[model samples]
Target chain A: MTPRIAIQEESFDLAAETARLTAGRQDVGGLASFVGLCRADDGLAAMVLEHYPGMTERAIARIAGDATGRWPLLGLTVIHRVGRLEPGAPIVLVLTASAHRAAALESCAFLIDWLKTGAPFWKREEFEGGAERWVEAKAADDAAAARWTPA
Target chain B: MRVLYFAWVRQRVGMAEEEISPPPEVRDVAGLVDWLSGRSDGHAAAFANRKTIRAAVNQDFAGPDHPVAAGDEVAFFPPVTGG
Candidate 1:
């Protein structure tokens, strides 16, 4: 199987990733995917993603593993790109495969939500005229993650 | 121990990583932050708002009271913004 979790500087091919998980596999009934892109918001020139090397991989793996445990996942892939990236570049990709749509879809959402709060990656946006600032964590993102918590 | 900084913390602290020996009284993440803040103005500024910072000891998320010792890889960074 293609690696279930990945953190690298190079971009990912969504089609290729999807094919890898589904190819020659009748067991997979559904596959859900989410791709995050770098937007040119507020005249931003580019952004750089920074992460803790060993910690980032482990953090994401833990999140993926949680999804695997909670849902019946047949296959999963999480690719997050580091280093400098221009606007319109892809930032992250999440793919969750399962025997049904609900498990595939919900687990995909859960993985991304938890990744937002629990993962160690950070983005530094470089705006026009050489000014740059670290992207602030959104309260809404925290709220989004919180909704997934089991009571 | 090797301390690492990322994102704004790295920029403010003016270095990516460093080796430091805190006094024996410093036993956890919070204590280490307090001791590090005394090292320089930049260090103080980087850790000025403890609420905005997060810590990891030996690559695992660590709370303020999380035990730490020598030969650990501790990292401090702002709240994660990645998806």
Candidate 2:
């Protein structure tokens, strides 16, 4: 069976991941996937992602578990890359499969939203002149995650 | 206890991890932060803005009031910005 969560320095193949999740699975009628890329905004040359090793995996698994609890998902996958990445490289991926489109699509969206704020990964940007700075968390990302919380 | 730092917090703190024994009065995350702030200028600078600093006790997200004891693994970091 394909692993549901992966945190690695190497990149991933979306097509292969999708096939592995749905291959020979007739019950899955909908599969939604989201891929996040590193943008070369401003004079950016590269981006470095740092994470708390053991905590990163545990935190992601917890979030993935929450998604499964909230939706009738047949399968789910979350891949996040760490270390140094060039502009345009893929940073993260979220795939959700279910019997219907609604569950798969909504769960996929929910996973990414929660991952943005809940995961223990940090991003540092390297500019063209060799200057580097850590990326600041956005309040909007927190708000996005908050929308799912019970009032 | 073992304390770890990440991202900008790590950068400002000048090291990734450290071993420290806090005084008994340091019973919680906020108290620990106050004690750690006196260790050095780097730590004080890293935690200058309390709102920007986040913490984890034994790898789980923790708040200021979270109690911390000896032999625990505590981590200090900035708000995460990952997708």
Candidate 3:
């Protein structure tokens, strides 16, 4: 199987990632993807992402595993970038492939939703005037992830 | 035991990682937090609001009541805000 998880500082090629996921696989009928970008809020200059070296990967892999178990996913790819990033830069990508669109779409959503709260990454935003602050977690994100809880 | 801090927690604590031995009464995450908070003003400030802090034991998400022992890695940070 192709590598399903990547945590790196370099940018990734979406086309290449898609090709790799479907390579030699005629079973994949649908693909869903989500890309997260750094936002340039008022006075925002840069955003820096920090993560625990070993725990970050483990947390993401556990989230991917949970998605795979809940959905009929044929393939999955999760890429998260670390280090300083400018506004408009891609920060995360979640791509899911399955035999049908519903599974692909829902699983893609599930992956990103879980990743938002469950992953170990922390973001610090730097404003134009040399002020920096750690971004606070949103209750909305927790609510979003909570919806997927087993009934 | 290794205690790690991240994000603003590290900034407030003034260090990223530290090695220390806690008293026997500090047997779980909450107890550890209480003990650390008393060590210095920085730690006290960082841990002032327990509601905003989160913990992980041995790379797994944990609760305040989670049991902790020697030779374990415990990390504390603010709630995660990643995508």
Best candidate per DockQ, number?
2
Regions of model 3 farther than 4 Å from truth? A1-3
TM-score of each: 0.97, 0.97, 0.98
Candidate 2, which CAPRI tier?
A: high
lDDT of candidate model 1 versus the reference: 0.93
- Tens-digit per-residue lDDT, A54-117, candidate 2: 9999999998888888898999999999999999999999999999999999989999999999
| All candidates: interface RMSD | 0.6, 0.5, 0.5
Q: How many residue pairs clash in each candidate?
A: 0, 0, 0
Query: A146, model 3: CA deviation in Å?
Result: 0.6
What is residue A34's positional error in candidate 1, in angstroms? 0.2
Worst ten in a row by lDDT for model 2 chain B: B4-13
What are the chain A TM-scores of the candidates, in order?
0.96, 0.97, 0.96
* Model 2 lDDT, residue A78, Cα: 97
Q: What is the TM-score of chain A in candidate 1?
A: 0.96
lDDT of 1 at A80: 94
Classify candidate 3 by CAPRI docking class: high
lDDT of 1 by residue, B1-83 (tens): 99999988998899999999888999999999999999889999999999999999999999999988999999999999898
Mind giving the per-residue lDDT tens digits that candidate 1 earns over A15-118? 99999898888999999999999999999999999989999999998888788888998999999999999999999999999999999999999988988999
Clashing pairs in 3: none
